[model samples]
Target: MTTSKQALPPVVSTATWQKELAALRIREKAVTRELDSVAAQRRRLPMTEMPDYVLEGEDGPVRLAEIFGEHPQLIVYNHMWHDGAEWQCPGCTGFTTQFTRLLGLEKFGARFVIVTQGPIDQALAYKRRVGNAMAWYSTANSSFGSDVGAPPDAGFAVNVFLRDGDTVYRTWHTDGRGTEQLSHLFGLIDVLPYGRQEVWQESPEGWPQAPAYSKWATSQEIAAAYGEDK
Candidate 1:
Protein backbone atom coordinates (compact mmCIF):
# COMPACT_ATOMS: atom_id res chain seq x y z
CA MET A 1 0.00 0.00 0.00
CA THR A 2 1.17 3.51 -0.82
CA THR A 3 1.51 5.99 2.04
CA SER A 4 0.53 9.61 1.61
CA LYS A 5 3.13 12.34 2.15
CA GLN A 6 2.85 13.82 5.64
CA ALA A 7 3.25 17.47 6.51
CA LEU A 8 5.63 18.01 9.43
CA PRO A 9 6.65 20.81 11.77
CA PRO A 10 9.98 22.57 11.20
CA VAL A 11 12.99 21.22 13.08
CA VAL A 12 14.50 23.48 15.71
CA SER A 13 17.48 23.50 18.07
CA THR A 14 17.06 21.78 21.47
CA ALA A 15 17.16 25.12 23.24
CA THR A 16 14.51 26.60 20.96
CA TRP A 17 12.24 23.54 21.32
CA GLN A 18 12.48 23.60 25.12
CA LYS A 19 11.82 27.35 25.18
CA GLU A 20 8.69 27.03 23.06
CA LEU A 21 7.40 24.02 25.04
CA ALA A 22 8.00 25.85 28.29
CA ALA A 23 6.03 28.83 27.02
CA LEU A 24 3.17 26.55 26.03
CA ARG A 25 3.42 24.79 29.39
CA ILE A 26 2.50 28.03 31.14
CA ARG A 27 -0.76 28.21 29.24
CA GLU A 28 -1.40 24.50 29.83
CA LYS A 29 -0.93 24.97 33.56
CA ALA A 30 -3.33 27.92 33.55
CA VAL A 31 -5.97 25.84 31.77
CA THR A 32 -5.43 23.05 34.28
CA ARG A 33 -5.95 25.42 37.18
CA GLU A 34 -9.09 26.82 35.61
CA LEU A 35 -10.47 23.29 35.16
CA ASP A 36 -9.73 22.51 38.79
CA SER A 37 -11.61 25.60 39.91
CA VAL A 38 -14.57 24.66 37.73
CA ALA A 39 -14.61 21.20 39.26
CA ALA A 40 -14.62 22.70 42.74
CA GLN A 41 -17.57 24.86 41.84
CA ARG A 42 -19.37 21.84 40.36
CA ARG A 43 -18.97 20.02 43.65
CA ARG A 44 -20.71 22.91 45.43
CA LEU A 45 -23.67 23.05 43.04
CA PRO A 46 -27.07 22.25 44.56
CA MET A 47 -28.98 19.12 43.54
CA THR A 48 -32.62 18.52 42.60
CA GLU A 49 -34.79 15.71 43.94
CA MET A 50 -35.60 12.97 41.37
CA PRO A 51 -38.59 10.70 41.29
CA ASP A 52 -38.15 6.94 41.75
CA TYR A 53 -38.83 6.15 38.13
CA VAL A 54 -39.07 2.50 37.17
CA LEU A 55 -36.62 1.37 34.51
CA GLU A 56 -36.27 -1.96 32.75
CA GLY A 57 -33.34 -4.00 33.96
CA GLU A 58 -31.93 -7.29 32.69
CA ASP A 59 -34.32 -9.10 34.97
CA GLY A 60 -37.42 -6.86 35.17
CA PRO A 61 -38.62 -3.45 36.20
CA VAL A 62 -36.45 -1.75 38.84
CA ARG A 63 -36.62 1.57 40.64
CA LEU A 64 -33.88 4.10 40.05
CA ALA A 65 -32.84 3.91 43.71
CA GLU A 66 -32.48 0.15 43.43
CA ILE A 67 -30.08 0.54 40.51
CA PHE A 68 -27.71 2.47 42.78
CA GLY A 69 -27.11 -0.79 44.62
CA GLU A 70 -24.93 -0.11 47.70
CA HIS A 71 -23.42 3.09 46.33
CA PRO A 72 -24.47 6.53 47.46
CA GLN A 73 -23.57 8.09 44.13
CA LEU A 74 -24.71 6.99 40.69
CA ILE A 75 -23.45 8.04 37.27
CA VAL A 76 -25.60 7.13 34.31
CA TYR A 77 -24.58 7.51 30.68
CA ASN A 78 -27.61 8.01 28.53
CA HIS A 79 -26.86 6.03 25.40
CA MET A 80 -28.54 7.11 22.19
CA TRP A 81 -30.90 4.71 20.44
CA HIS A 82 -32.78 4.12 17.18
CA ASP A 83 -35.98 2.13 17.31
CA GLY A 84 -35.86 -1.28 15.59
CA ALA A 85 -32.47 -0.51 14.12
CA GLU A 86 -29.77 -3.14 13.76
CA TRP A 87 -27.17 -0.76 15.23
CA GLN A 88 -27.23 2.18 17.61
CA CYS A 89 -25.29 5.40 17.80
CA PRO A 90 -21.62 4.82 17.08
CA GLY A 91 -20.58 7.83 19.17
CA CYS A 92 -22.39 6.51 22.19
CA THR A 93 -21.34 2.94 21.45
CA GLY A 94 -17.70 3.96 21.15
CA PHE A 95 -17.78 6.35 24.12
CA THR A 96 -19.38 3.77 26.42
CA THR A 97 -16.75 1.26 25.37
CA GLN A 98 -14.11 3.37 27.15
CA PHE A 99 -15.69 2.36 30.49
CA THR A 100 -14.92 -1.35 30.60
CA ARG A 101 -13.99 -1.51 34.27
CA LEU A 102 -15.97 0.42 36.89
CA LEU A 103 -14.75 -1.10 40.18
CA GLY A 104 -12.67 2.05 40.73
CA LEU A 105 -15.89 4.06 40.97
CA GLU A 106 -17.31 1.90 43.76
CA LYS A 107 -14.35 2.79 46.01
CA PHE A 108 -15.63 6.35 45.88
CA GLY A 109 -19.14 5.18 46.85
CA ALA A 110 -20.26 5.52 43.28
CA ARG A 111 -21.74 3.23 40.64
CA PHE A 112 -21.68 3.75 36.88
CA VAL A 113 -24.11 2.26 34.41
CA ILE A 114 -25.83 2.85 31.08
CA VAL A 115 -29.42 3.83 30.39
CA THR A 116 -30.76 3.68 26.85
CA GLN A 117 -33.99 4.58 25.05
CA GLY A 118 -33.93 1.16 23.42
CA PRO A 119 -35.69 -1.75 25.09
CA ILE A 120 -33.77 -3.60 27.78
CA ASP A 121 -33.24 -6.72 25.68
CA GLN A 122 -31.99 -4.74 22.70
CA ALA A 123 -29.72 -2.69 24.88
CA LEU A 124 -28.28 -5.79 26.55
CA ALA A 125 -27.88 -7.45 23.19
CA TYR A 126 -25.99 -4.43 21.93
CA LYS A 127 -23.97 -4.46 25.13
CA ARG A 128 -22.95 -8.05 24.46
CA ARG A 129 -22.35 -7.25 20.82
CA VAL A 130 -19.90 -4.49 21.71
CA GLY A 131 -18.36 -6.39 24.67
CA ASN A 132 -19.29 -3.55 27.01
CA ALA A 133 -18.86 -4.55 30.67
CA MET A 134 -20.87 -1.79 32.30
CA ALA A 135 -24.31 -2.58 33.69
CA TRP A 136 -27.01 -1.75 31.12
CA TYR A 137 -30.57 -0.65 31.77
CA SER A 138 -33.54 0.61 29.75
CA THR A 139 -35.29 3.96 30.17
CA ALA A 140 -37.45 3.30 27.11
CA ASN A 141 -40.64 3.11 29.14
CA SER A 142 -39.86 6.07 31.36
CA SER A 143 -39.27 9.80 30.97
CA PHE A 144 -35.90 9.58 32.74
CA GLY A 145 -33.99 10.16 29.53
CA SER A 146 -35.87 13.38 28.64
CA ASP A 147 -35.94 14.52 32.27
CA VAL A 148 -32.14 14.38 32.35
CA GLY A 149 -31.65 16.07 28.92
CA ALA A 150 -31.15 12.93 26.79
CA PRO A 151 -34.45 12.50 25.06
CA PRO A 152 -35.31 9.40 23.05
CA ASP A 153 -33.52 9.29 19.66
CA ALA A 154 -31.26 12.08 20.96
CA GLY A 155 -27.52 12.20 21.57
CA PHE A 156 -25.54 10.82 24.50
CA ALA A 157 -25.28 12.34 27.99
CA VAL A 158 -23.75 11.89 31.44
CA ASN A 159 -25.95 12.39 34.49
CA VAL A 160 -24.73 12.37 38.08
CA PHE A 161 -26.97 11.56 41.02
CA LEU A 162 -26.64 11.32 44.80
CA ARG A 163 -28.64 8.94 46.90
CA ASP A 164 -29.86 9.78 50.42
CA GLY A 165 -31.45 6.65 51.87
CA ASP A 166 -34.28 5.74 49.49
CA THR A 167 -34.37 9.13 47.80
CA VAL A 168 -32.21 10.21 44.87
CA TYR A 169 -31.19 13.71 43.78
CA ARG A 170 -29.77 14.84 40.47
CA THR A 171 -26.41 16.48 41.08
CA TRP A 172 -25.17 17.28 37.59
CA HIS A 173 -25.90 16.61 33.93
CA THR A 174 -23.67 17.18 30.89
CA ASP A 175 -23.88 16.52 27.16
CA GLY A 176 -22.16 17.56 23.94
CA ARG A 177 -18.54 18.56 24.48
CA GLY A 178 -19.08 18.59 28.22
CA THR A 179 -18.71 14.79 28.05
CA GLU A 180 -15.22 15.12 26.52
CA GLN A 181 -13.55 15.22 29.94
CA LEU A 182 -14.56 11.59 30.48
CA SER A 183 -13.18 10.33 27.18
CA HIS A 184 -9.71 8.80 27.39
CA LEU A 185 -9.58 8.49 23.60
CA PHE A 186 -10.34 12.17 23.10
CA GLY A 187 -7.87 13.13 25.82
CA LEU A 188 -5.06 11.28 24.07
CA ILE A 189 -6.05 12.36 20.55
CA ASP A 190 -6.15 16.02 21.63
CA VAL A 191 -2.46 15.90 22.62
CA LEU A 192 -1.27 14.64 19.24
CA PRO A 193 0.37 16.92 16.66
CA TYR A 194 -2.64 16.77 14.33
CA GLY A 195 -5.04 17.02 17.29
CA ARG A 196 -8.12 15.05 16.26
CA GLN A 197 -7.50 16.23 12.72
CA GLU A 198 -11.03 17.56 12.58
CA VAL A 199 -12.06 20.56 10.48
CA TRP A 200 -13.59 22.60 13.32
CA GLN A 201 -10.48 22.77 15.52
CA GLU A 202 -8.29 25.88 15.31
CA SER A 203 -5.11 24.13 14.22
CA PRO A 204 -2.07 25.55 12.52
CA GLU A 205 -2.07 25.79 8.72
CA GLY A 206 -0.92 22.69 6.75
CA TRP A 207 -2.28 20.35 9.44
CA PRO A 208 -4.32 17.43 8.08
CA GLN A 209 -8.07 17.96 8.40
CA ALA A 210 -11.20 15.82 8.03
CA PRO A 211 -14.87 16.29 8.81
CA ALA A 212 -15.93 15.57 12.38
CA TYR A 213 -16.41 11.84 13.12
CA SER A 214 -15.27 10.92 9.64
CA LYS A 215 -12.77 8.55 11.21
CA TRP A 216 -15.29 7.11 13.64
CA ALA A 217 -16.58 3.54 13.22
CA THR A 218 -20.16 2.39 13.33
CA SER A 219 -21.38 0.06 16.10
CA GLN A 220 -21.62 -2.79 13.59
CA GLU A 221 -18.01 -2.34 12.58
CA ILE A 222 -16.84 -2.34 16.19
CA ALA A 223 -18.89 -5.42 17.01
CA ALA A 224 -17.64 -7.23 13.94
CA ALA A 225 -14.10 -6.63 15.15
CA TYR A 226 -14.99 -8.67 18.25
CA GLY A 227 -16.18 -11.62 16.08
CA GLU A 228 -19.79 -10.88 16.91
CA ASP A 229 -22.31 -11.05 14.06
CA LYS A 230 -26.05 -10.35 14.02
Candidate 2:
Protein backbone atom coordinates (compact mmCIF):
# COMPACT_ATOMS: atom_id res chain seq x y z
CA MET A 1 0.00 0.00 0.00
CA THR A 2 3.10 2.24 0.06
CA THR A 3 4.98 3.57 -2.89
CA SER A 4 8.72 4.05 -3.21
CA LYS A 5 8.71 7.71 -4.10
CA GLN A 6 10.49 8.58 -7.32
CA ALA A 7 10.45 11.54 -9.62
CA LEU A 8 7.49 11.16 -11.93
CA PRO A 9 7.77 11.58 -15.69
CA PRO A 10 7.05 15.17 -16.73
CA VAL A 11 3.95 13.95 -18.63
CA VAL A 12 2.40 12.31 -15.56
CA SER A 13 -1.40 12.20 -15.45
CA THR A 14 -2.71 14.51 -12.75
CA ALA A 15 -6.07 12.77 -12.24
CA THR A 16 -4.47 9.36 -11.94
CA TRP A 17 -1.95 10.73 -9.45
CA GLN A 18 -4.74 12.35 -7.46
CA LYS A 19 -6.55 9.04 -7.24
CA GLU A 20 -3.36 7.38 -6.01
CA LEU A 21 -2.90 10.07 -3.39
CA ALA A 22 -6.46 9.60 -2.18
CA ALA A 23 -5.97 5.86 -1.90
CA LEU A 24 -2.81 6.43 0.10
CA ARG A 25 -4.71 8.72 2.41
CA ILE A 26 -7.38 6.14 3.02
CA ARG A 27 -4.81 3.46 3.74
CA GLU A 28 -2.97 5.80 6.10
CA LYS A 29 -6.12 6.57 8.03
CA ALA A 30 -7.04 2.89 8.30
CA VAL A 31 -3.59 2.08 9.67
CA THR A 32 -3.81 4.93 12.11
CA ARG A 33 -7.18 3.84 13.40
CA GLU A 34 -5.98 0.28 13.80
CA LEU A 35 -2.92 1.42 15.73
CA ASP A 36 -5.00 3.69 17.92
CA SER A 37 -7.28 0.81 18.82
CA VAL A 38 -4.25 -1.28 19.70
CA ALA A 39 -2.90 1.54 21.82
CA ALA A 40 -6.20 1.85 23.60
CA GLN A 41 -6.31 -1.88 24.29
CA ARG A 42 -2.78 -1.69 25.60
CA ARG A 43 -3.75 1.14 27.88
CA ARG A 44 -6.74 -0.83 29.15
CA LEU A 45 -4.86 -4.09 29.70
CA PRO A 46 -4.14 -5.21 33.26
CA MET A 47 -0.71 -4.43 34.69
CA THR A 48 2.00 -6.90 35.42
CA GLU A 49 3.20 -7.70 38.93
CA MET A 50 5.26 -4.82 40.31
CA PRO A 51 7.59 -6.23 43.00
CA ASP A 52 8.12 -9.49 41.19
CA TYR A 53 11.44 -9.48 39.39
CA VAL A 54 14.67 -7.53 39.39
CA LEU A 55 16.58 -6.74 36.22
CA GLU A 56 20.34 -6.19 36.08
CA GLY A 57 21.41 -2.59 36.50
CA GLU A 58 24.64 -0.60 36.35
CA ASP A 59 25.32 -0.48 40.09
CA GLY A 60 23.90 -3.91 40.82
CA PRO A 61 20.62 -5.83 40.66
CA VAL A 62 17.59 -3.58 40.95
CA ARG A 63 13.88 -4.29 41.30
CA LEU A 64 11.37 -3.21 38.67
CA ALA A 65 9.89 -0.69 41.05
CA GLU A 66 13.23 1.06 41.45
CA ILE A 67 13.40 1.82 37.74
CA PHE A 68 10.21 3.81 37.93
CA GLY A 69 11.88 6.59 39.88
CA GLU A 70 9.38 9.47 40.24
CA HIS A 71 6.91 8.28 37.63
CA PRO A 72 4.47 5.39 37.71
CA GLN A 73 3.99 4.69 34.04
CA LEU A 74 7.19 3.42 32.44
CA ILE A 75 7.91 2.79 28.77
CA VAL A 76 10.11 -0.23 28.23
CA TYR A 77 11.69 -0.92 24.87
CA ASN A 78 12.57 -4.59 24.49
CA HIS A 79 15.92 -4.35 22.76
CA MET A 80 17.47 -7.28 20.94
CA TRP A 81 20.98 -8.29 21.84
CA HIS A 82 23.24 -9.31 19.01
CA ASP A 83 23.45 -13.05 18.61
CA GLY A 84 26.01 -14.67 20.93
CA ALA A 85 29.13 -12.55 21.62
CA GLU A 86 28.10 -9.46 19.66
CA TRP A 87 25.73 -7.94 22.22
CA GLN A 88 23.62 -5.13 20.80
CA CYS A 89 20.92 -4.67 18.20
CA PRO A 90 21.24 -1.92 15.57
CA GLY A 91 17.49 -1.63 15.18
CA CYS A 92 17.13 -1.24 18.94
CA THR A 93 19.75 1.49 18.80
CA GLY A 94 17.66 3.22 16.18
CA PHE A 95 14.72 3.51 18.56
CA THR A 96 16.89 4.64 21.45
CA THR A 97 18.07 7.57 19.41
CA GLN A 98 14.48 8.77 19.32
CA PHE A 99 14.59 9.46 23.05
CA THR A 100 15.92 12.97 22.62
CA ARG A 101 12.66 13.78 20.84
CA LEU A 102 10.45 11.69 23.16
CA LEU A 103 11.43 13.70 26.22
CA GLY A 104 8.09 15.40 25.85
CA LEU A 105 6.33 12.11 26.69
CA GLU A 106 7.45 12.82 30.23
CA LYS A 107 4.68 15.36 30.50
CA PHE A 108 2.22 12.50 29.99
CA GLY A 109 3.63 10.96 33.20
CA ALA A 110 5.60 8.21 31.52
CA ARG A 111 9.32 7.43 31.41
CA PHE A 112 11.29 5.20 29.00
CA VAL A 113 13.76 2.38 29.50
CA ILE A 114 15.47 -0.28 27.41
CA VAL A 115 15.66 -3.91 28.50
CA THR A 116 18.17 -6.03 26.67
CA GLN A 117 19.74 -9.46 27.04
CA GLY A 118 23.07 -7.69 27.55
CA PRO A 119 24.22 -6.57 30.99
CA ILE A 120 23.53 -3.18 32.48
CA ASP A 121 26.99 -1.76 31.83
CA GLN A 122 26.82 -2.74 28.19
CA ALA A 123 23.37 -1.23 27.75
CA LEU A 124 24.56 2.00 29.36
CA ALA A 125 27.58 2.17 27.06
CA TYR A 126 25.40 1.86 23.94
CA LYS A 127 22.92 4.34 25.36
CA ARG A 128 25.84 6.75 25.70
CA ARG A 129 26.82 6.26 22.07
CA VAL A 130 23.29 7.06 20.92
CA GLY A 131 23.23 10.17 23.13
CA ASN A 132 19.98 9.11 24.78
CA ALA A 133 19.35 10.31 28.34
CA MET A 134 16.58 7.76 28.75
CA ALA A 135 16.77 5.02 31.40
CA TRP A 136 18.10 1.58 30.43
CA TYR A 137 18.78 -1.81 32.04
CA SER A 138 19.40 -5.41 31.07
CA THR A 139 17.27 -8.49 31.51
CA ALA A 140 20.54 -10.50 31.45
CA ASN A 141 19.43 -13.11 33.94
CA SER A 142 15.91 -11.94 34.59
CA SER A 143 12.51 -12.93 33.20
CA PHE A 144 11.24 -9.39 33.42
CA GLY A 145 11.19 -9.01 29.69
CA SER A 146 9.74 -12.44 28.99
CA ASP A 147 7.02 -12.26 31.58
CA VAL A 148 5.88 -8.94 30.26
CA GLY A 149 4.91 -10.55 26.93
CA ALA A 150 8.01 -9.05 25.28
CA PRO A 151 10.61 -11.75 25.57
CA PRO A 152 14.19 -10.66 25.01
CA ASP A 153 14.33 -13.25 22.28
CA ALA A 154 11.42 -11.48 20.62
CA GLY A 155 13.76 -8.80 19.28
CA PHE A 156 12.00 -5.48 19.77
CA ALA A 157 8.83 -3.62 20.77
CA VAL A 158 7.80 -0.49 22.70
CA ASN A 159 5.80 -1.43 25.80
CA VAL A 160 4.19 1.07 28.11
CA PHE A 161 3.50 -0.17 31.65
CA LEU A 162 1.52 1.92 34.08
CA ARG A 163 1.62 1.90 37.85
CA ASP A 164 -1.02 3.50 40.03
CA GLY A 165 -0.10 3.37 43.72
CA ASP A 166 0.72 -0.27 44.55
CA THR A 167 -1.22 -1.61 41.56
CA VAL A 168 0.11 -1.44 38.04
CA TYR A 169 -1.43 -1.58 34.56
CA ARG A 170 -0.27 -2.24 31.03
CA THR A 171 -0.70 0.53 28.47
CA TRP A 172 0.26 0.86 24.80
CA HIS A 173 2.84 -1.10 22.82
CA THR A 174 4.00 -1.04 19.20
CA ASP A 175 6.07 -3.45 17.08
CA GLY A 176 6.34 -1.65 13.78
CA ARG A 177 7.81 1.65 12.58
CA GLY A 178 4.59 1.97 10.60
CA THR A 179 3.35 3.38 13.90
CA GLU A 180 6.53 5.41 14.32
CA GLN A 181 6.33 6.33 10.64
CA LEU A 182 7.41 9.78 11.69
CA SER A 183 10.92 8.62 12.65
CA HIS A 184 13.60 8.58 10.00
CA LEU A 185 14.85 5.19 11.07
CA PHE A 186 11.48 3.51 11.33
CA GLY A 187 10.41 5.03 8.05
CA LEU A 188 13.28 3.38 6.24
CA ILE A 189 12.00 -0.09 7.14
CA ASP A 190 9.72 0.10 4.13
CA VAL A 191 12.60 -0.89 1.86
CA LEU A 192 12.96 -4.19 3.71
CA PRO A 193 10.80 -7.31 3.32
CA TYR A 194 9.74 -7.61 6.95
CA GLY A 195 9.18 -3.88 7.23
CA ARG A 196 11.28 -3.41 10.34
CA GLN A 197 10.55 -6.45 12.44
CA GLU A 198 13.22 -5.05 14.68
CA VAL A 199 11.91 -1.70 13.51
CA TRP A 200 14.33 1.08 14.35
CA GLN A 201 15.22 3.84 11.96
CA GLU A 202 14.52 4.87 8.41
CA SER A 203 18.19 5.49 7.79
CA PRO A 204 19.46 7.36 4.77
CA GLU A 205 21.17 5.49 1.96
CA GLY A 206 24.58 3.84 2.65
CA TRP A 207 24.15 3.50 6.40
CA PRO A 208 24.33 -0.09 7.71
CA GLN A 209 20.89 -1.30 6.55
CA ALA A 210 20.62 -4.21 8.95
CA PRO A 211 22.98 -4.82 11.87
CA ALA A 212 23.83 -8.41 12.76
CA TYR A 213 26.49 -9.96 14.95
CA SER A 214 29.17 -11.81 13.02
CA LYS A 215 31.75 -14.23 14.35
CA TRP A 216 33.87 -12.96 11.45
CA ALA A 217 34.37 -9.48 12.96
CA THR A 218 37.38 -8.60 15.07
CA SER A 219 36.71 -8.32 18.81
CA GLN A 220 37.55 -4.61 18.79
CA GLU A 221 35.22 -3.85 15.88
CA ILE A 222 32.40 -5.91 17.34
CA ALA A 223 32.78 -4.39 20.80
CA ALA A 224 33.02 -0.82 19.60
CA ALA A 225 30.49 -1.19 16.88
CA TYR A 226 27.92 -3.57 18.39
CA GLY A 227 28.74 -3.86 22.11
CA GLU A 228 30.32 -7.31 21.64
CA ASP A 229 32.08 -7.40 24.97
CA LYS A 230 29.06 -6.27 26.90
Model 1 lDDT tens row, 165-230: 999999999999999998899889988988999999998888999999998877877787652563
**TM-score of candidate 2 versus the correct structure, residues matched by position:** 0.63
TM-score of each model, in listed order = 0.95, 0.63
The CA-based lDDT of model 2 is what? 0.64
Q: What is the TM-score of candidate 1?
A: 0.95
Which digits, one per residue and each the tens of the lDDT, describe model 2 over residues 46-100? 6445545688877788777777777877878787776354435555565565556
Q: What are the Cα lDDT values of the candidates? A: 0.90, 0.64
Q: After superposing candidate 2 on the true structure, give the runs of residues whose Cα lies further than 4 Å from its correct spot.
A: 1-10, 13-16, 48-51, 82-84, 130-132, 149-154, 171-184, 188-230
> Which candidate has the highest lDDT of all?
1
